[model samples]
Each structure stands twice: as structure tokens, then as C-alpha cells.
Target chain A: MTETTLLTFLQWIDLVGVLFNAVLGAVIGRAARLDVVGLVVLAIMSGLGGGMIRDVMLQSGPPIAITDWRYITAALLGALIVMIVRVEGRLWDRIYPPIDALALGTWAAAGSLKTLEAGFGVLPALMLGTITAVGGGFVRDMVLRRIPGVLGGNTLYATAALAASLVAVGSWYLHVPTIGSIAATAVGAALVLLARWRRLSLPVG
Target chain B: MTETTLLTFLQWIDLVGVLFNAVLGAVIGRAARLDVVGLVVLAIMSGLGGGMIRDVMLQSGPPIAITDWRYITAALLGALIVMIVRVEGRLWDRIYPPIDALALGTWAAAGSLKTLEAGFGVLPALMLGTITAVGGGFVRDMVLRRIPGVLGGNTLYATAALAASLVAVGSWYLHVPTIGSIAATAVGAALVLLARWRRLSLPVG
Candidate 1:
């Protein structure tokens, strides 16, 4: 696919990721027994916080989450979905992992790619990418007065994002950013799934 | 003062706020028995987080914290001070309230003024201003797995910031933003000090 086509595809994935994360955030809010305002706040924060942070750091203009209407709409729709439907039990358990993994992978890929395009260095790209993948959940956890799971959990979420970022950055250097984005997403999703399946936890100091 | 002079003065106060908050953050880290890295992280987050959030939301240039060397330097200097001195006891107690009050006032004034200058509406200015005043401590508290003191407790921090923001915005409308900035700062500082002195706490819903 051409670069523009690749960007368009990624944009769609980004919206999907936003929707899924927003739903998850609202679900968390439900679990916490928050009011409607709290639920919506958590949904928006979880859906858009990471990308907003990345865009702000990149200094590349306003975050698309704010500039584009669709991002917020998607997030709100996710909140609406959770508010109306009782998404729980065995069916939710069956779908949650893949949805979360896809969100992580797509978000990481998009973040790293955007960083590279904005003329940032490899270190920043990696940092921003990992932040983009995990930042929403981190902020959500914090707002709930919980220690961010990403900081100390045995989960490989952050590590997987880092690896995906490396792959994307490597692809950029090879002059095949399009392929790199696709490959990075796949690698990130695969790794997260593998980690979850094996209960792979990083050793803590 | 002329507009430029007013800006320069606020810039100085802004740095002072960064220094004070960074020290406070490190103090909290020390209280938590955090390592050096944790201290530094908390210091930077508390020092710069609020303004960064405001600037990013404004969608203006890069955060002054990142573009200006003095901001980071001031924050690090705060960490250095905390690491070198055991800043607890009667002397620290006598000093902390005034220092914290000053930081909150200056930050709210700066944030509100900047928001108006950016051509945003009054509500955004107020919201951003409050975030500027209280966001650092909120983030720090979250990182420490504690509920933000601003959200509960009888403290009038957020309310004081709102008043400061209102003053600043009011001044802008009168074409006296310089006076507005100064007045806003004074109002914010005084309110915070009064709250602390009276042990005033807002009622939680």
C-alpha cells in the first residue's frame, strides 16, 4: 500500500483502539461504582490520554483526539455501549484479551510512526510509543487511586510496546515504513497474546 | 508594569513555583522512602506537570518546560536541595504553607493569563488555570497511590485557583491583564493561606 493508504488504515485502527479502550475504561468505572460523570471521564481519559500525550510531546500541533471529531465520538460511543449493555461474564472474558492486544499494538505502531515522521530521535520514538500504548491505562489507574499496573506488574505490556517500537523504528531505517507499521502491529499483538497465554511476567528488582 | 515586564515577572514566579513544588515532591518521595530515581521523577512531575498539561491542551508551541532550560534546571535544583537537606521540622513547617500558597497563586495567574492570550474562552481558561495550579500535586498523589488531596479534604486549592482564574480573566476583559495577573496571584495566595490558617475544607458531596 502507498504511504497515504497506510496512514488511512492506521487512522481507522486508531479509532478502533480508542473505542475499545474507552469501553474498557467505562467497564472499569462500572466496577468501581463511579457516577456517570466519572465513567465518561474515565472513558475519555483511557481512550485518548496516551495519544494526546504523544502529540503534545511531539509539539506537532493539537492532538488529533481533540482536533478530529471522530475520536471523541468513538470514545463516547464506547461509553454508551457499556452504559447500555451488560458486557460481562464468559463472553467478555473470551474477547477482552484480543481487543486489548489489538489496541496496544495499533497504538504503539501509530505513535512510533508519528514520532519518526515528526523528526524525533529513536529514543523519543521508543519512549513515546511505549507511552502511547500504556499511558491511558496508567492515567486511568492513577485517577482511581491505584498504582499504575504498568509500573510494577509482571505483565509485559510496556516491554511489548518497546519491542514493537523497535520494530517500527527499524523498519523506518530500512526505508519501508509501511511494511514496518504492519509488521510492528502484528509483532506487538502476537507478543502480548503470547505473554498472556504463558502468564509471562517480567522479573522485578 | 508594561506587558513585557509583567510577563518577565510572572516567568520568574513560574520558575520559583517549579522549584518549590519540585522540592515538595522530593520531600514526599523521601517520606515514602523512595530511591534517588523515584525522588527525581516525582520532583520533575510535580514541578512541571501542571504547566505541561496546560500548554499541551492549548495546542500552542512546545511546552516552555521543554523549550526553556531554566525550568528543568530549577526542578533538578529542587531535587538537589531535598537530597542534601533534611527539610523537616518546625522551620520547614513554618515555611511550607507560605511556599505552597505562593506556588499555587503564581501558577494559576500564569495559566489563566496565557490561556486568554491564546484566544481561548473563559471556561477553558478557568479549567486550564485550575489544572495548572493543582495538577502536579494530583499526579504526584496518584503516583504514590494516594487520593489527591485536592479532590477531598477541606482544602480550597481548586476553588482558590478558580477565583484567581476569574480575576485574571476579568482583568483581561478590562484591558488590564498586567494588573489582573498581579491581582489574581495575590487573591489566590491569600485564599490558600486563609484556608490553611482556618483549617478550611470544602464539603465533599
Candidate 2:
């Protein structure tokens, strides 16, 4: 694909990731029995907080999510949808994990790419990428007064993000095409979903 | 005071504020029964997170705390102190609140001054100032899986910060001597301690 097309595709992925995280945040807010304001706050924070943190750390000026209206709008829409529809029962239970895995992978890839574009070194880029993927959820969990799933004894969340970020960063170093990064993201998401399905977890001390 | 002396005084206040907050953070970590690593992480984050966030938002590169090793060393010392000598009982409790209040006020003043120095408008300065003051405690509470003391119905913690920030920002705008800002911060801390002593709080809805 052309450069413009690739960029557009990447933007779409980023948007999708944001939306998914927003929905997940709203779901958690609902579980916490928070008010509407709380739900919306959590949604927006989860959707954009990580990227904002990363950008700030990168000294990249005001975060793009803040400067651009679309990201906020998307987060608001996702929150509204979740609040209005109230997706529950077995269906949501079955679908939530996969959607979350997809968000994790996409965000990790996008963050790594952005870091690379900023001309940072490999380790910082990879670390920032994982932070971007998990930071939002961490904020959400914190707001709800719970240990973050990534830090707690849960399925491999940060590990998957790290894997996806590594792929994206490695692809850049190897001079792979942009499309290769997307494939790597997909592989990462697949790994997360598979791990969840198999009930796999990293050993704890 | 001369400009050089005034600046030196302000820097000392800033250091004291960071150390106070770091001790409070370590105390909270111990209360949570966290390991030494968790204690140190919480201390550093509480001491530096707010300033880092403010600097990032202002597009100030590499947060001053990260550049100056003193802040990190102070935080480490605070954590180590808490880890080695367990402060408990009613006497420790009585002292903790006042120290925390002092930290809050100084941080609020410092953050507002920094924002003003960055040439931001008054409102952003005030908001960022309050954020910087309360942000470290917020992170600590979140990591411990408890509702943030500021967000929860408490003795006007964030309000005190805002009040201090307003005083600082207003002092700068009125061309009051820099020492006036220190007085304002003292007043802010006094108000918080008074509120706590009186069991005062903002009414919950």
C-alpha cells in the first residue's frame, strides 16, 4: 500500500484501540457503581491517559489526543454507547477479553511507531509502547479502587503489550515495511487471546 | 530579599515539600503492607509524579526531578527510613497530618509558580498547581487500591491546594514580592490542618 494509505490505516487502528479501551473502562465503571460523570471520566482517562503520558515523557508538546478533537469525541461516543446499551450477560463476557486483547496489541504497536518516529532509542521506545498500551487501564483500575489487572495476578496483560511493542520496534530496526508492523500486532493480539483461553499466567513471587 | 536569595529560599521549600511527601508515601506503602520495592516506587512517584506531570504538560523536557538526583535520593531515604524504623501509634498519627498539609501547600505554590514562569495563563496555572499538589497522593491511593483521598469525601485536600495555587498565581499577577507567595502557602497549609482538626469537609451529594 501507498504511504498515505498506510498512515490512514494506522490512524484507524489507533481510533479503534481508543474506542475499545473506552468501552472497557465504562464497563469497569459500571461494575464499580460509579455515577455517570465517573463513568465518562474513567472512559476518557482510559482511552487517552497512556498516550498523553508517553507524549509528555517524549517532550512531544501537548498530546495529540488533547489537540485533536476526534480522539475525545470517539471516547465520548464509546462511553455513551456502553452506558446506553449496557452490554451484559454471557455475550459480553465472551467478547470482552478478545476486544481488550486487540486494543492492547494495537496501542502497543502505535505507541512504538510513534516513539520510533520521534527518533528515540530502542529500549525507551519499547518501554513507552508498553506503557501506552497498559497505562489507560491502569488509571481506570486505580480510579475504581482496585489493583490494576496488569500488576495483579491476572492473565498476561503487560506481557502481551511488551511482546507487541517489541515486534513493532524490531520491525522498524529491521527496516521492515509498515505493513509488517501491523502483522506483528496481530500476532501479539493472537498470543494474548490464546493465553487467556489457555488460562496461562506468568509466575508470581 | 534579593532575587538570588528569594530564589534559593523557594528551592529549599520545594525540596522540603518533596521530602515530606516522600515520607507520607512510604508511610502509606507500609500501611498497605507492600514490599520494599513497592515502598520505594510509591515514595518516588509521590515525591515526583505531580511535578513530572506538570512539566510534561508544559512541554518542559525531562522533568526537573529526573534531572536532579537529589529528589530521587530524598525519596529513597524516606522509603528506607520507613522500611527500617516502623513509625506507629497515636503520636506518629498526630504528626503525619500536619506534615502532609505542609507538603501540599508548598507543592501547590511551587507548581503555580512554575506554570506562571512557563508563561501560561492564570487559570491553567492554578489548575496545574492544584494537580501537582494532589497528584502524588492520588497516585499513591490508586496504587494501594483505595479511593483517592482528594476525590473521596475528605477534609478539602484538593480545595486547600487550589486555594494555595490561587494565592501564588494572584501574588505573581499583582507583582507582590516573592516572599508573599510563601506566606500564602503557609496560610493554605494552616487552613488544611485547621479543617482536619475541626473535622470539616466539603459536603457530599
Candidate 3:
């Protein structure tokens, strides 16, 4: 594929990631029995909070989520769809984790690329990328009065984001082709899924 | 007083505010039974998180908190003092609220001034100012698994910050002299203390 096509595909991946995270946020809001305003707030925060932090850290003008109406619309639409459909029960329980992993990897890769493009060093880029992938969920869980999944005994969620970010940043630093970066993202997402499937967790003292 | 004297005084207010907030954060961390790392993290977040957010939104370069080693040192010192002193019992309980209010007003004023200097409009300046005052506490409370004191019933804390921010931003917008801005900050701080003394609060629905 052309370079333009590769970039477009990556953009699509980011959009999908945003939507998936928004849905997950809405679900958490529902479980918390929050009002509509709370649900919407959670949706937006979970969908874009990390990217907003990244953009601000980079001093990259107004965050894209704040500027682009499409992103806001997408997040709100995800919340609305979940609210209307009420997608709970066994089916959702089975599918949610995998989708969440996909979103995490995609966002991590996207965040690292943005940071790299803005000329930050690799370590900062990797850190920001991991933050971008996990920030929204952290805020959501905090609001719900729970320890953030990343910090607590959840599956290796943040570790997955970090892994994806490292791969993406490594490829960029090596001047690998864009397609190679895309493959790295996939590898990261797969690792998250594998960790989840095997019930892997970081040990706590 | 000379212009240099006035600037130095304002800087002192900011330093005092950071120290007060850091101590409060350390106290909370102690209550939560967090380790030394957690205590220090809470202290830094409570002291500098709001300013970092404000600077980022203003598209300023690296946050002053990150660039200035003095700020970091101040926050760490606050945390260490709390750890060593363990100021609990009646004395701490009585003194803590007033100092916390003082910090809130000072931070609110400082945040408003920075926004005005960055050429933002009055409304954004006011909003960012209020955010800067309360953002640290919000992060701390979130980490501790509780509703943010600003959002929940907490003795009109956020309201006081907003009031202080409004006065400060209004003075700046009116092109008042620096002394006038200083007086405005005083009035804001006085209002917070008055609210606390009178046990005033916004009514919950």
C-alpha cells in the first residue's frame, strides 16, 4: 500500500480505539449507576483523557479531542449506543476484555508516534504513550471509587500499553518502515490478549 | 515597597501554598497506609499537578514544576516533614483546614495571573485558575478511592477557589495595578476563611 494508505489505516485504528474505550467507560458508568451527565463525562474522559494529557505535555496547541467535533461526536455516540442497548450479561462479559486490549494497544502506538513526531526523546515518548493508553480508565475507576486497574491486581493492562509503546518507539528510532510500526502495534495487542488468556498478573508485595 | 519586593512577596505566597498542599497530601497518604513512594507521589501531585495542567493548556513549554528544581524540592520537603513529624491528633486537625484554605486561595490567584499573562480570555483564565487550585487535591482524592472533595460535599472548597479566581482574573482584566491584584487575592483568601468559620456550604440536591 501507499504511504498515504498506511497513514489512513493507522488513523482508522485510532478512531476504533477511541470508540472501544468510550464504550467501556460507558459500561463502567452504568455499573456505577451514575446519572446521564456522569455517564457522558466518563465516556469523554475515558475516550480522550490520555491523548489530551499527551497533547498538553507536547504543547501541541489545543488538544485534537477538544478541537475536532468528530471525536467528541464519536465518544458521545458510543455512550449513547451503550446506554440504549444495555449490552450486559454473558455476551458482553466474554467480548469486552479482548476489545479493551485492542483499544489499549492502538492508543499506545498512536500516542508514541505523536510524541516522536513532536521531537521528544524515546523514553518520554514511551511514557507518554503508556499514559495515553491508560489515563481515561484510570480517571473512570477513580471516579467509581476503585483502585485503577493498572495500579491494582487487574491483568497486565498497563504493561501491555508499555510493551506496545516500546515496540512502536523502537521501530521509529530505527527508521523502520511505517508497515513495520503497524506490525509492532499488532504484536503489542496480541501480547495483552495472551496475558489475559493465561491470567497473568504482576505480583504485589 | 519596591517592584522587586512585591514580586518576591507573591512568589513566597506560591511557595507557601505548595508546601501546605504537599503536607495535606502526605497526611492523606499516611491515612491510606501508603508507602514512602506513594506519600511522595501524592505530595508532588497535590503541589504541582494543577499548575502543570494550566501551563500545558496555555501551550506553555515544559511545566515550571518540572523545570524548576526548587518546586520539586519544596514538595519533597513537605512530604518528608509529614513523614517525620506525624502531626496528628487535635492540633493537626484544627490547623489543617485553615492552611488548606490559604493554599487554595493562593493557588487560585497564581493560576489566574499566569492565564492572563498568556493572553487567554477572562473566562478561560478564571476556569483554569480554579482548576489549578483544586486539581492536585482532586488527583489525590482520586488515588485514595474517594469522590473528589471539590465534587462532593466538602465545605465549599471549589466555590472558594472559583470566587478567588474570579476576583483575580477580574482585576487583571480591568488592568488594575499589581497592588490591586494583591488585594483581590487577600479578599479571596479572607472569604474562604470566613466561609470556614461560619460553616458555610453549597446545598446539595
Clashing pairs in 1: B154-B201
The local distance difference test score of model 2 is 0.79
Q: What does candidate 1's lDDT look like per residue over A1-205, in tens digits?
A: 6789987997788798899899999999999999888889999999999998888787987889999999999999989989999978899888888878878988898898888888766766776788899889889988898766665443578778878889999999999888888888888888989989998775431
> Positional deviation of B175 in candidate 1, in angstroms?
2.1
> Where's the lowest-lDDT run of ten residues in candidate 3 chain A?
A147-156
CAPRI grade, predicted model 1 = incorrect
Docking class of 3: incorrect
Clashing pairs in 3: none
Which lDDT values do the candidates have, in the order given? Answer: 0.85, 0.79, 0.78
Q: What is the lDDT of residue A131 in candidate 2?
A: 93
TM-score, candidate 1, is 0.61
Q: Each prediction's DockQ? A: 0.16, 0.16, 0.16
Location of the lowest summed lDDT over 10 successive residues in candidate 2 chain B: B196-205
lDDT of 3: 0.78
Scored by TM against the true chain B, the candidates give 0.96, 0.93, 0.93
Question: Evaluated with TM-score, which candidate comes out highest?
Answer: 3
TM-scores for all predictions? 0.61, 0.60, 0.62
The residue-level lDDT of candidate 1 at A58 comes to: 78
